[model samples]
Target: MDVSKIHGFNFPCPIRFGAGASKELTDYLKANKLSRPLLVTDGTVAELSFFKEIKNDLQQKGFSVEVFSEMHKNPIKSDVLKGGDAFHETGRDCIIGIGGGVALDVARAIVLRVNHKRDLFDYDDLIGGDKYVTEDVPHFVTIPTTAGTGSEVGRSAIISEDESKKKRILFSPKLMARMVFADPLLTMELPPFITAATGMDALTHNMEAYLAKNFHPMCDGIALEGIALIANSLETATHRPDVESRAKMLLASLMGAVAFQKGLGVVHSLAHPLSSLLDTHHGLANAVNLPYGMQFNYEGFEARFDKMADAFGLSKNNGNRVVDHLFEMNDRLGLPTKLSAIGVEAKHIEELSELAEADFCHPNNPKPVTRADFKNLYEKAL
Candidate 1:
């Protein structure tokens, strides 16, 4: 593929693609001049036999590798600190982030603290609003076990605060992984519901980025293509879980991450708080909030949305059709439609709305959303 033909997209990572490319982990480590590498993953993925294959290979190559599965799902600040302690204790000079978003986030934070002398909160872009003090932390390689989150290419890590229910993002270009290995085989074990939810999350990334009021054509084209791909393949992949469908979903996720570099809007803003507060699955929260944001942004970018609707094969002209299609998609995929259906309540609306409005993604929304607008959306979504 002539990557330049895709307009504004550029990925600096040395990405290896295919079903079994994960077997090349040892070769990649050698190529990158890494010897002792700490493998960071959550308890869930660490328990899988697939991870043991890579672990044993590194051992045979005389590359000291250690496993840390103490990572949390939402990835608390303490988790990163603990991971940092392990990195220091083992004298590991490189990191292999080998799980989902939480593990990836922890790995990113651990690398930063290895050489720098600052509290994790101090480096947070959300709270401290400070630029990350990026030194050469480690040569990091990310291998995503799931086809969601896109933390492999993301330049920020979301860590929960010390005493708060909210999560904060630590940002820097140096936080991006040095290499990413996209192996479709890893996604084969994913359950149908997770596949549906994560695929929808990727779709939301493309949709929100395309709808964002930004001037980046590169992100726009990537988002459009990503959205189209997800619409076409998500259902098939969830039901079938074959190599072809898995490859398409994985590629869609990569494209979604690249697309959202332009910006994301209220869907992410709303979803973040839901994940923090309700402990709902991140992708499911995004799925529930997506339609409301679509309706809200429709008037501001009807033409762009019209183009998207056509691309998604909707016969109608605006976001309403897109919203209807999403509802149907959710139903087919066995996802809950309303917040109430997912155990959220009317009482929680005020607090969630306030926090959501303050979320970083709010300003990038194509339309300005007020507290009332948020409450109304929550009520309607409920």
Candidate 2:
């Protein structure tokens, strides 16, 4: 790796690794001097046996712990407000964000608004105001149950706005979790399709970050390794359902999240609006848009894609092989291959294209995207 090619980058995060690492959560909190904590997670994850063990451990450690599980799949401003109010009412000094991205994002927003002003939209990066984040945001820890989204290590939270009908990004380094616990055991029971979709989502993150116009070798290296790991383990993890595969998948997801701190591209930009308009699962939406984005960026990323092929053990000219592989992987994993297959229609393309072009992530893509480009991509995906 030529270190000279990359410059001006900052990476910050503490990571706890391996299986059964989640058992050390209370010790981590105590080491950081947090005694009162709120466990922020979704209802489905809260019902998992993993959360049961976590709840028992926190209580046994003599910490005052409260649960807040009202966050939605695509969290909204109202959801953040509710979560912040819950944190204030509980008088928690720390937050334990568990489950998937939605829960972690909610936890970040809750901490952001804990003792601050009430207007959640004021804090959104798209709203043209100063960031609401402060160093006083609660001590936070994250444990992700799903092997996608990578919110455990991410510094940004995505939420939907009812009025705008689009997803908004809220970013702050202060919102980063103090500790990120990657425990593969918690992901063992995930359904095959969910595993596949989330794995593809992680792959998309790595691809987009690598293709983004950013000067960060560390993030680039991380993205390459993340892509390789997903290539090596996604299929096995989806079909075998073993601890080792699960562990690799979880690590890959975290790596993807860490890498994308550089930026994302058209896939995520296009997927976000499609998800909002069609009620598509976030990961699945990314999966459907992956190939289209790859084709769009093909000319610009030929050399990079070839390098990625080398890293993933593909032939020299097989630069775009991942696209075909992703389609096959989606079919094997029982996910939708096309937008139309998933119920997205031509009628929504005009609106979806305009919103996708307006997306913040669109500018970071390796290839410049115009409204016509977005419309074509949407039509191609369908």
Candidate 3:
């Protein structure tokens, strides 16, 4: 992949985007005068040759690199504290998050813990907590290895609360990474199933963001374009895994995160509980629930769905056509069409509904979502 022609952009954040952009890490670190860096990643990504190669390159350049890779898929509050201990123990001056959403989120949370004196829950975004995140944290860089979640560029990190078993959003401008290396090459080796699920997650983000009852035209425009990009390249990126397709999906994922600052809807509200309760893959949970969520939201946002259908190139521009297109896309991507297919049962509906109703994302939905509405949506998905 000749990424020499690729360029960097500073759209609210400095991003080095292309196939081989990961190779610029040394230059970025040097330019910022950051040497003692802690690399935060997941255990699986730490085993990859890409991570090993970067570790070796940094070591050869005499940069002391420490790593913390013990975080969970849904990182708990304790994991953030443990990561903070490692960060301080190693005397790391900066943090480089080098994997998917989990690692990036934990990295940001760890940075928060490094400087703040309060407990992690004190800064939860749900309870007017953004003011508590007042300290200037360490310099942070994010390199995403997956094309989902887009936590690399996000200002909030979702960490799980142990006792409640619910995901908590910790939001602050300080959590945003100072730099992001959006290299599609990092996602090339991902399995087709993962690629499909994550691609659908990205699509859901853009679609739901567009449908949310927000007054941001800039975010609306970005969301629509993000959806178009995913519709065009997701299937190819999943099945064939080429550079162009991967690059497009990666870019779309970033756009999804950027646009979703406007808001997300019931899809994320539904998916977060699945992750907290069933330990389901976040992307897969979102993929399974997205169409049902869209269907449930369609009555209030028929014009939005019509626009989305047109974006997907459906001949008929209507809400039903949008739902049909999503079903078709799920089939083509080999994703589960029903919640039952993913081990979700009828018994789980009430609890999932309660959790979904209480979720921060529920209020932003285009259609007002109640506990009863959530139960009905769960039943429909099942």
Enumerate clash totals for all models, in the order shown.
Answer: 1, 0, 0
The lDDT of each candidate is 0.82, 0.83, 0.89
Each prediction's TM-score against the native?
0.94, 0.93, 0.97
Native-structure RMSD, model 2: 4.6
Off by over 4 Å in 2: 1-11, 127-132
Q: Candidate 3: where are CA atoms >4 Å away?
A: 1-4
On TM-score, the stronger of 2 and 3 is 3
Write one digit per residue (lDDT tens) for candidate 3, span 1-382: 3454557888769899998998989988998999999999999999999999989999899899999998877899989999999989989999999998889999989888899979888998889889998888999999999898888899888999877777888889988889999999899999999999999989988998898888888989888888888988999999998988898889889999999998999999999999988889999999989888888888867778888887777744665788877888899999999999998999999999989988998788887888998999899999
The best candidate in terms of lDDT:
3
Per-residue lDDT tens digits for candidate 1, residues 253-290, read 88888888788998898888887788888899998888
In lDDT terms, how accurate is model 2? 0.83
Better of 1 and 2 by lDDT: 2
Model 2: per-residue lDDT, tens digit, 93-164? 888899888899888878787866846767677775335555477788889999999998887788888666
Total backbone clashes of candidate 3, pairs 3 or more residues apart or in separate chains: 0
Considering every candidate listed, which one attains the maximal TM-score?
Answer: 3
